[model samples]
Target: MSAPLGVIVAVRGEAEAAVVAEVDAHPRLTVVRRCADLAEAVAVARAGLGAVVVLSAQPHLDADAVAAIRAAGAGIVGVGGGPGSRLEALGIAVARSALAEAVLAAVSGPAPEFVAPPERGTAAMVAVWGSGGAPGRTTVAVNLAAEAALAGHRTILVDLDTYGASVATALGLADEAPGIAAAARAAARGEDAGALLDRHALEVAPRLRVLTGLTRAARWPEVTAPGLERLWPALRAAADVVVLDLAAPADAGASPQGPGPRRDGATLAGLAEADVVIAVGGAEPHQLVRLVHVLLDHDGPTPVVAVNRIRAAVAGPRPEDAIAAALGRHAGVTEVWPLPWDLRACDAAARDGRTLAEAAPRSPLRRAIASMAEVVVAAARAARDAPATVTD
Candidate 1:
């Protein structure tokens, strides 16, 4: 006297009876409903009318209908045969007796109650920006994403630096691909961001998907704060980590269009939403001054300052000590990391469109980047595992 398990049949004519008989053959499953078409089947499934769906593997069955049923959270089983009988590709398969036995054994045994997936809304943003010219924001972002992927996290690197979009070039990837702009447009139109993601994502690394910036700067209008906010939740739900390569707003003067107000661009939006910000700086006195000024304006979490191209022979005054002192005087930046100058390795890797780890894993600069990434990951994990508290 176990509860009945509903089944939906999606074949033409009297085949419904045959399908119901097949499903009822299993002792655990009691056929509760027989659907004439995929729409009716989907409606029944959505209303919690079935535990599993048994549908025919027919050519007439629309792919969208199958996708809709799957999205509604039902276990699907395909029967009979068709040109596209490859059910496994669509995350469904024929339920044989042996497979049913395995499933029953799993269900009957003491199993942990399934924890619902995390609520999807608002991304955990991390922005990588530099203080001045060539402080290496792209390098930090690319390496951070690679480290996250290496740890088996599905990660994405988003290039939001409208002024100089070098993420594609740095990864040795081509520019013919669509990216964040497409996602933004879809969000503006109230379209599903997941569908947009599937279209624009470029798998640069094994577990890393990169959303490159606009193909050209003129397309900046296509990306707005609201659009980004709308798309972020979906992107975050699909990725374990998101690294943003941001343009240094301090160098807005460098742009030929004349220094526009910093608050007018997407860089501000990116920083405002960032959970972690990697503020890159050089050993030069002016660079340290600019870094401090920038840090003071950052309203998000405390940023980590990465000192790039620290060369004692060229830049003078022990790089780390000088950079730390300058930051301490202005913003108390005690967590400064000095990266050794490795132009040959960085240049070679960029030229070949490969990450530093893949191109020059032994470089000191690359090691520093990896260490920085580890620190960020640890902090994020600690926050996620912390107990939730309700406050009045």
Candidate 2:
């Protein structure tokens, strides 16, 4: 004879007694345990005491519990629920009257087996960084995000600058409570991993959303790696591309003795996770010097440089060619994208709270940014497809 089906009952209110009786009366089903709550039911399943949990559909029977039940290697027949309940996805939703048949049938079949979800590639993380003195990291990040979106990719502009985020101001988004800072704080407190994308992401354009940064500079420490560790996966899952606007690189060059100097947790995390890094720098000599030093100092991935605000006055004649030559010779950088000065377009967008693509698509600066987005996308794809290098 076939082995009796090991079942457990976890229900409340009127459905409780009926479910227990039904399982008890069924010849093929055996009451392995009657759990007081979902936690105990999950525990019982984890301990191999129950192979099936007859769970009640109540307000407290949340998706998390059902998932726990499934993850614990137990199939569940949800009772006391109707057509539009959360437990319907479990594929065993039943009313109190149908509880006996549902439980017996679910248990009669082979026990639920854990199946790994199929893997799908997400949009690569692109870090837009700048050396200090306002190299326009926000401008680069926001435009790149918008451009990526315009290129038919879902993108999110994340302002990770703990010291005064400008994405909201740049996009004219409402300064609200659910900004990155708030999400970071909540994630630090161990909230759902997807909360970062589900609750905080704000749509600025058709395919672009922006996660505004910390409103107060004092909350810089709140954007920790631990919080972002839980957030990046969710963000990647939500968007096809993520353009992280990082603050000026500053890790104090921690020596080799210890864990080294602590960099901004978010910046460190972003750099670590990024598949492409775009280093935006000013066109002037001082900014160029700083950029050179920063690239060398940063012990992270190599970056493509974008010389922003290039003008005849600052960069001399043949500005684009000149800057490219300088960085290539001095910094050994071959890929240099020189963006022309367009103060009028930038100012207009800032004032109107719109991206350049939306406010002034015809502007040279906007066009340059769009071209750069294409380059970044190509680089990301190349990096993703490249064979992993083996080392001795």
Candidate 3:
């Protein structure tokens, strides 16, 4: 005969004894341990003493803890919490009544899966990141998104630069309305993130929307990885192409507040979830060095290098060729998109709160950005249409 499935009950209050009693009555299940708290339950799970942990809803229980417990080879069955509750949000909840029957159903099959609704359309996420030397990441992102929108792709320009968020300012929109942060907060509350995004995203042009970033740098903590984790899928469902203008840091390590939100959470999350990553860098010698470091340090998706402001004065004769050669030699980057110096066009666009195409259609920079956008959109479409792979 098959052995009874080992179950660990970690719930508190009266629910604990009730759950234990319910499990004991089951012939195919047995209560192996009654953990005092989440930590003890986690330890027991890590040691493989239980196949499933019956946990109670607690404020301290979060995605990280749930992930650790699950990674330790134990499935979770949350015993409490109603709609929109943390437990429900974790995708492991079983109703308080008929607990044993629910547990049996959950254990008999696979763990409850949280599959986001099929997106309205496949949207490719393009993340524009830099190595902190101000390689005009935002400028590149804004123009590319504009070009994509002009090309008939519904595009969203998300300013996730927590340090100095200027997408709203550059687009001449009022910063009073909370954009990405508000959507994130809604996602964290287990609300409709796509609906919130639709309400918060400002339509700058016909097909182009902008999700502004933090108004104050100190508000970085409000945009956590967990919140963005929920927001990303909603973003993809809302648009055809999502362009993320990330902050300079790729990996800022742990938060100074310890175990809490890190300032670079947005950037890291964007990079991790991106379908295409554009590493922007200036054409200057020093900027080239920093760009190489940025490219080398990046371990996520393969990035396309964009050398901005390729001027002969800054990068020597045939600046594009020179920059490409240097990046290839140093960073082993073969494919490089060179954007020329168009200070007049860039300044005009900034002053008018418009894109280069709108401000100066004839600008060399705009033309180059148009070409790059074509490539980006094609890549995004290809990625979206590609078949998903599964591994054991």
Best by lDDT: 3
Report the alpha-carbon TM-score of model 1 versus the true structure: 0.64
- Each model's TM-score? 0.64, 0.67, 0.80
Candidate 2: segments with Cα more than 4 A from true spot: 1-121, 251-263, 385-392
> Which model, 1 or 2, shows the larger TM-score?
2
Ordered from best to worst lDDT, the candidate numbers read 3, 2, 1
lDDT of 3 at 278: 89
lDDT of each: 0.69, 0.76, 0.83
Report the C-alpha lDDT of model 3 over 233-331, residue by residue, as the tens digit.
888898989999999864445435443457887888989888888899998889999999888888876798898989999888788888999999999
> Which residue pairs come into collision in candidate 2?
254-261
How does candidate 3 fare on TM-score?
0.80
| Number of the predicted model whose TM-score against the real structure is largest | 3
Runs in model 3 with CA error above 4 Å? 1-76, 79-86, 96-111, 118-120, 251-260, 389-392
- What are the candidates' C-alpha RMSDs? 13.3, 9.7, 4.4
Tell me the deviation in Å of residue 68 in model 2.
27
